[model samples]
Target: MTSAAKPEADQTVSGQLRRALHPGGWSLRGRLLGQLVALVAVACVVMGVVTEVGLRTFLLDKLNGQLAGSIQRVDSPIGGDQGQLPLGPPTSGRLRFLGGGAGTAIVVIDNGTVTDAYTINQQNYGKPVKLPPDALAAMETVQVGKRPSTVDLGGSLGAHQVIAVASDRTPGRVLIVGLSVVDINSTLLSTGLIMLGVALIAVLLTALAGELIIRYTLTPLRRVAATASRVAELPLERGEVALSVRVADRDTNPRTEVGQVGSALNRMLGHIANALAVRHASEMRVRKFVADASHELRTPLAAIRGYAELTRRSGDKVPPDIARAMDRVESESIRMTALVEDLLLLARLDAGRPLRRQPVDLTQLAVDSVSDAHVAGPDHKWRITVPDIPVIVPGDEPRLRQVLANLLANARTHTPTGTTVEVAIAQLDTGEVRISVTDDGPGIPPSLLPEVFERFARGDSSRSRAAGSTGLGLSIVAAVVTAHRGNVTVTSRPGHTEFAVHIPSED
Candidate 1:
């Protein structure tokens, strides 16, 4: 790959990733599952927080009560002069001081210096246990008569429920006693993590269950959609539209919302089928009338021209005014005959009349058609370019020639007298013959281009009506090309307009 393309490829992949992860872009099923899981997650998180706060408060309150009872063991008036702890079975009471577990610690300070310290089993006193700095700072901020509070102490001491009070054993001294809350914090953390794990499991289950339930609920709606889809693929725009498709009996029960949709769809399809039938009948009648009238008018039109010519040839004395009138009558009759013949040809093509499938040289047809266009509009420029090789295609010879003539004549008539018209015939790599007529004239109006090939479609107001176009030329080109199992299209802009026909080439 080139260096320029690498960044573009990366950007495309990144864009795809962003779209997949975006919540708003998710499908209906994904969104439903996500919302359900989110609700479950929020509920779990709120429950976990409330439970943690309540448990911590209860444990702290219990620790404070233990510190209060331990204070009674001190004796007053032993004074700062002595550092001995008051002796007693002081351990006894509703207090259980005798069994003060390893988590308990108590200390006494005189003049801001530790004079005595003890712990359950009396651990670490010989090494001189000291009160943590945070607890000491918290004691300085305590107001008189406020409830005892908790402080976080350093290292092994962890967090504590501590109280600052006067030493009963020594005057001008202080007591800081606390029980370790490491066990309480440890318990809360473990339980919190377990609760978090359970919350995750609940969310996962909610997502799975939501997806299953939504799929089951929408199953009937999907069946109804499939029924409509099959009907949409039918060729309803042409000929007979047999719309017999309907939703299943179970889907059309009408008790559920999906069932209501299915029932309504079936009714709509039925109405459309009736409308198409009526349209087909109307079109058949119109085709029959045009065909019959054109066939019957041909003989009269020929006789009118023949008698007018015979009168001009007769040696008898005819008045000058009568000869001129006969000329006018013959001219009008010839024009009317051409119109009738065009209508008959269109009606037959619409009726799907078969044409002879002979191999015809498309290049020769372009040459002959351009030659005729030159004679018809000698003032207009005419040109043709054919490939050295024969551009052979299959169709009726006469009909294909008519297709080329119509296209060339359309270009010559719509363009100004001095405009240039060119006809081209080429065989495409895909083994189709491409015949195009291009003109360097004022293009068709943008608004009219879409319907330019419709029957009797006329050009802009500025177009000269003196050319006597029956407006069936391009329409015939389109119809005959279509009947030969081909396609026709046109494109136009200022100073350029082109009509191209593609027909399958024979081997």
Candidate 2:
């Protein structure tokens, strides 16, 4: 392979190995259970291997001992002849007397020539059968005076562990004795199979028990996670949040690892609850202060406007500059009064004061608000679109009318002259009423869209201060709609701006 191709192939193999080792998206419980099962399987495999090796060694040693005893018997003096080999067909009798078992092969090589070669055949009633030439040839290769070695002799003799020893009586004669190792092989095979079966059973039991124990151990952690999820779902950005969700007392025992987590979660929730209480208390104080201050400022603001108008019409010859000053004073007083009224309304809404519920006709409200906008901003074109059938929603009539008025005033004040402002009201199929105010003009800046409905939020360029905007019109609209359990949203781009309010229908 090329050098570049080698790196690619290596990378592919590495990636495959990584994926095989660490599969993605496995949960904690699954990972723990898998590790436990893998560990048990590995241990079972190791134990089986060790036991198989030990058993095979022990069996081989026993077979070797039997072979040694056969060699010792072959060398022992028999029938008053000092280790002289019996000749002819009587070799089978001599071998039986020497304790040779079935499948045992015996070979006698005298002066480099095999004289007698035979094996005990148990099927033939202990009769010795003449060994085949191939069996004798395989037996002659056995090393003399060495440890028993396994050799395969073809034609039904199979394999045998044989040892060759020099004859004591004859200098050139050699006796070869061997015992079959087929039984030992069969025993080891059976033992290996049994070990595998037992190991599999043990691994299965371990897996089952581990799964149950791991599940039981992680139950408390699951409960703690559930509590945290519930807390996250709560609306805690504003107002008095109850913050009542907490880990169960039993789960928070602080003994086990999961219990410690549960305990920490409970303590954290307690701190959050206390913080929310303090925040609600601070918010309450601010709302009360604003409501009281606005209430107190109302009377004095009314007096200032009344006195300014009264002086302007007193028929006294006033200077032109003084008349302008008086006019400015009355206009600013009116603006301040409007600001104070908006603040007071926001305070009441923040206090969660309930609104008066009644079936109010949104079509009529749209028409009246548009007519008022036309009078206020004569340079801007105003239009209203309402269904032929009236759309009525259960809400306070005054508050709903104010919502439409504020929306229309906002459109008129923000857009330039000749911009067409359209007021559209419709009853939706989902049992809700929608009031949308759209204007074809330079839309609100993109930066201000997120907080457009927040108090005193206004664009510096599109929204003009000379139009006497109190900057709380949209905020008031949002507060009143929220009090009636409705929602308001704004969308703005270059040439289009729309403010939509959705209120659920009474029916």
Candidate 3:
């Protein structure tokens, strides 16, 4: 590799390693398992490297000692002066004097020229084998008096640990001794393979055991999550809610990490339940107050209307202003009575007072409501579309009729004269009877669409109070529809506004 390319390669390898250690989008459990495995792998690699290095060092030291002994025996006076043999073919006699075991190579050099070179043939029971010229030439590079050196003498001699020394008997003669390190290399290879296999087995066992332990430890957290999910699915926004869901008792022990979380969650749920109970109690009290106040005001309002009418017609000619004042009083009393009735009805619906349920034909109800709207607002165009067959739904007849009447009244009061108002009733394929009131006037403002059915929700410009809009008509429609187990929705844009109600069919 070129020098400039080396950094790029190193960066690539480092990036790969970093990504493997901290992969993106890993879940908590996956990250934990990966860290555990990576730790074990690093420890195993370190152990293998240390074991191989230490074993090679010990083996090499022992081989060097054997090399020293071979040099002592070959250079001994018992063999011959200068340990020099005849400059001829290597013989068994020379092999016996070398003393080192098989696979030892020795060379005799005289005055910078090789005189004899041979190695012991281990396959032939320690017989001497003459070294090739190339192998002898490779050994000649070992420096004289050096401690030790490793030389690769190619062609079956392989690598050898060699040392050279000058002759004491002859001034110019040199002795070079080498021993094959093939056995050391083979031993190291075998040990490495064994260590690798054992490390892999250990890692596999650790992974399995760690996974089991983690899953068992997280079981309580899973249960806590399931409980929270169930609670989330409950209808806790309205009415009297029974917030009964809670973490299991064993899971909320507070002794473990997940247990601590579970305990805190249970405490939070308990507080919310208490708050919901309090809110429901407060709402009930308010509803009762409104219902009682409305019931009590009926008698006094009736008396006021009766007295004003009686005073206006007492068989005596009265001033025009006084008569007109009596007329205003009667009209206001009538409007106030209607407002009280609406409030009482809303209170009863909030208290879950059961309504009379019977199969009512929605087609007939739509026609009647549209007819009443036409009579009330004769300047506006009114249209009704209903199926030839009566589409019946199980609900309170009076309440359903009131729902249609309010929807039509809302369109008539808000739209300009001559604006078309349509009433449509049909049975849907989903076993629902749908009633829709659509108008082609200046549609409701987009800001008011969300809370159009809320109590006292009215537009400021187009739907003014001068139109006798108390802002409770739509609220009454919503309450009555909800009491009958139906849904109401409205959509409005420039030039179009629609109110749709869907009630489940009896069938």
**TM-scores of all predicted structures:** 0.79, 0.82, 0.81
* Top of the candidates by lDDT: 3
Clashing pairs in 1: 76-168
Model 1 quality (TM-score): 0.79
Query: What tens-digit string does per-residue lDDT give for candidate 3 at 311-422?
Result: 8778678888988998999988888899899999999998999999888888888888888888999999998888988888888989999999998888887888999999
How close to the true structure is residue 503 of candidate 2, measured as C-alpha lDDT? 90
Query: lDDT (CA) for every model shown?
Result: 0.77, 0.83, 0.84
lDDT tens digits, residues 24-82, model 2? 74668888888888898899889888987898788778888988877767656556345
Tell me which of candidates 2 and 3 scores higher on TM-score.
2
TM-score ranking from best to worst?
2, 3, 1
Collision count for each candidate, in order: 1, 0, 0
Better of 1 and 2 by lDDT: 2
Please give the TM-score that candidate 2 achieves against the real structure: 0.82
